[model samples]
Target: MGALMSVAPEPGWPEPEWHRPPVGGYTADDLDRLPNLPPHTELIDGSLILVSPQTAFHMRAMRLLENRLLEAAPPELDVAREMTVTLGPRDRPEPDVLVVKGEAEPRQTTFQPEDVILAIEVVSAESEARDRNVKPRKYAEAGIRHFWRVEEDKGLPVVYVFELEPATKTYVVSGIYHEQLKVPVPFPIKIDLTAINRRQP
Candidate 1:
């Protein structure tokens, strides 16, 4: 039998090494290769950014909002949750809830910006900045007509709606609703926020 020999650990062993890909180089296809991604992970400007985890309250509010949006959306539109919307070669954001122009095909990997009519983001403490500022700017520039941001005020959801100004590619405040979300753009619809909050209990 040969004498036993011990191998020394390499320098920086046990320390995970990170390779930084060039900015604006990553595409949606690259994002698809990664598996077991966290629920809120997103690709922004070719950077893989892991979003904050959703609190129970945030998820409950998101589900309630989705249900309301679905009930109000037109027959031609479909409301989905946490589906990636491809904004560009380097931008793929997964909105908390979104309304698309038509039924989603089974093999669809991502929704195109033109196909997304409305994008909604529910604010968590950790996601406030991106949800309120970053996403709105990107979604508007991508020509998504409507955007909604849901914020918790006194443990209740308050929704702020915005509509895109096409010429400027910017969003203008459409309405802000606390007890109810009522709007006519895309279609006429009313969501009773009070009722939704009651269901949380």
Candidate 2:
């Protein structure tokens, strides 16, 4: 009988190297192990973030703000709060308030910069830095139409309003409102910031 010949397998296949996966990619197990998160915590860019819980004062301010805008907004316009804004696959934020120029939906929906006419962040002692630096830059990069930062330290609803000018990759701080009532909002409608500022938190 002729000797049986064994064919060897091809030799050019890539070798498998066992390396730890990048931290940027988190598995379900990793997510599950995350500490118990407060209501304000949100996942952004695959990192866990702890946001300050909205105080009663904050809620009051937000509601009053929304109501005023609603009154001046076109029947088709929509205003929302604490809703998720997804900037990219890795970035999702829930701003204190968001104003949209479109038909009203029955419920709040996740939004993108394109869906937002304005994004508002309320700054408490803790969140001031993130709101000023992290969010503003992200909103600018995402091409948000406008952004507002309301600081609690001010006597009234002291806010900084910025309009996105993509040509410069930065926001044009169009106006600063010390007295809520005195601010001239550029949108085709008016909102009562004073009313919002008075809400009991």
Candidate 3:
């Protein structure tokens, strides 16, 4: 019993290496098999990235947008949140919101790129770069027809919508919207940004 007291508390946990890649780095399928992974873990360019905790604005905005999209979506389309799309062997990213074609299986955890018509990212301070640039490029490369990145401005959402240019396999800025997001592609969608995070009786 005395010996136990003699041991000092361990140093601040060293930089986590368990999520580090092996000889050739991680793969998309590895995400599904990895044990004890934090929820919403993403594989980006063969590196496992545990995303930052979402802000209150993020959660409310995401829910509001998802609900609105669901209301406006066509019968054949479905809206999902925080679901991964396996873009390639080295890339599987979970978007904040997705508009996917057809019905998903009960046990489906990942979707194929071809099935996703729109992937939306709600930008958080920590995820600005990835949300604005990295994700769009990958989504476009996989031929996803549309993408949206939402930014917070004084507690309101400002949406930037993009469309894939097949000739270059790149994304072209479709529009930047504030207050109201109205779009015609990938089926019509209109949202009132001010409604996000509003208190309801």
Candidate 4:
């Protein structure tokens, strides 16, 4: 007698009868199983999205910003990289950089925008749209008080600082830093736009 072959079920488990191709989505589990991703990819809207690769100048500016921010960071502040923030099932995004007030381990949940003191995104050609539109709304909806978009491609970061406007339920631009401007954060640090410009690729 011939052995019976077992057939695998279709991709979508619960609704096997519902015929539809998986419309590309990822769960937190999917993100966990991925092997190390290159720095240029970020997880957004439950899928891995490719961002523009950083250039030498971009890296230099990032390093400078990191150094300045780190030096003046409050003891309560925790600076991190490519960390995921759960913004509903369709809106989880891994920001390039974040400043938060508490440890991540014990919490186990991704950073809530309210938990984050600030969010900074370094925009390259590929990431310009999301950095400008999607992320700002995601952070704002999550109640993040401040956000910064750093445009490295322009040879200088056009910093956009947004603060939540309670009455309006939206973030209002508090400051825009093009050249030399002091950030309104409690701890003071000078972001040298000239230095950022000098390092542009």
Where does candidate 3 have its weakest 10-residue lDDT segment? 1-10
Ordered from best to worst lDDT, the candidate numbers read 3, 1, 4, 2
lDDT of 2 by residue, 162-201 (tens): 9889797688888776544334454564555666546442
Q: Looking at candidate 1, what is the lDDT of residue 142?
A: 90
TM-score of each: 0.85, 0.72, 0.89, 0.73
lDDT of 1 at 65: 82
TM-score result, candidate 4:
0.73
Compared with the true structure, all predictions reach lDDT values of: 0.78, 0.63, 0.83, 0.64
Please give the clash total of every predicted structure, in order. Answer: 0, 2, 0, 0
lDDT of 4 by residue, 86-147 (tens): 66665557676778886678636367667788787776565567878878887888787777
The prediction achieving the highest lDDT against the true structure is: 3
Model 4's alpha-carbon lDDT is 0.64
Residue 97, model 1, lDDT: 90
Q: Any runs in candidate 3 off by more than 4 Å, and if so which? A: 1-17, 199-201
